[model samples]
Target chain A: MEKTWIANLLPQDEYREKRLLYFIAEAVFILGVSLFLYLMVESFIVEMDMPGDRMALLCIGFLITYTTLRSTLTGIEYPDVASEKRYQKEKRLRIYSTIHFWIIFLFISILFKGIPSNLEETFDIGGSATFAAIFFFILNYLSLKKSYKKNKDLLDD
Target chain B: MSLNNDRKIRNRIAVLRAEWNLSQKQLAEELGVSRQTIHSLEKNKYNPSLKLAFEISLFFGVALQEVFQYEEEEA
Candidate 1:
């Protein structure tokens, strides 16, 4: 019988190995992004001595969205055409829940931080960038949870 | 668990799949799994779930007992 490429893409391991690989990959990705952001912010501070970065915030927002979506989508598997409906349900639930948490957490953080002293100017740029990181961090948790849920659902069904 | 009589078991799977006039893709889709699963099953590299076993039986128009049989092989 001919092999479909999808099967090769599927995570093939017991739960422990799968979880370990997932967390490791997540940590690596987060570390890479954090390092890049640290360098960029440091360079901006050193060179321009700017109070905030509008471009960087926009770039970070897009990067976080793209990475979160890509990683989350890659891990999903449907048993058959009949399962697509259920897959869609699970996908929606996972994504919406993530978004909800992101928004809530952002507001909570802003309230706790009591707005930066340079709110008007900084918010026009750096504020959103900070929010983007928060969004991605929350998304990381959501994606990890979704991955585990996918495995559990498969075993259950 | 390992195959009790590996060679004959391998031969049985090939025979069954061929007799049904089903392609690997078709069988995999019918089984609600990826094509690699069918290949692995054919190669005896992976075991099927009970649900998968029932589906195979239904697909081949055979009882599970007919599709898979245990033959004790002496060392």
Candidate 2:
């Protein structure tokens, strides 16, 4: 006999709907954490006598990181391609897109922000952006790998 | 369902399920897959893996060729 709790939690007949609901719940949780982080950053900037614009930049960075992490963790099944190929394509697309976006962002920043006018500030922005990009890319790769491994049996190929 | 392309892998799963007096949900449970997967297979929108194909043939006590046929266009 199937376990009652498991049946109730994941009714086999409603598997697709349940999966969608789980994804939404996860997205909400991620959003909540990001909001909390934004508040903490706001308080930190105020305490440090930093500029208000810094807070906005940090929040944007945090949102980008949160979005990348969420996509990595969600494991939403791709409907088009088979399993392994789909995961590989997803991983490649994610890394490439993140890198492309960051490059554009850096160019825009350098153009508008005048290259920070100092060696120290230039290093700070460049180093932080590079670190964040690397961190996001790695997170995406590992998460996709894990999801692919876990769902191998469920997928078509 | 109407045959769309000569390159498609044709399956008789719906007919077999009817003969066995099984619903899509029951067949999916027996095959250890989602009901949606069974529906997709019946509609020929998704191809089953080799293991799944073998399992289906085994479950129905029929040859694999009897359950699945690959149709090709004539020259």
- Kindly report which residue stretches of model 1 are placed more than 4 angstroms away from their true locations once superposed: A1-157, B1-11, B72-75
All DockQ scores = 0.08, 0.05
- Candidate 1 clashing pairs? none
Instruction: Please give each candidate's TM-score.
Output: 0.34, 0.40
Could you give the CAPRI-style class of model 2?
Answer: incorrect
User: For candidate 1, what is the lDDT?
Assistant: 0.56
Clashing pairs for predicted structure model 2, backbone only: none
Per-residue lDDT of model 1, residues A9-127, tens digit only: 44542222233345546655876797687679778766544345764675576665554465555443222222445556655665676567656666776676665568584464455
Query: Judged by lDDT, which candidate is best?
Result: 2
Interface RMSD of 1: 10.5
> Highest DockQ: which candidate?
1
Question: Which 10-residue span in candidate 2 chain B carries the lowest summed lDDT?
Answer: B32-41
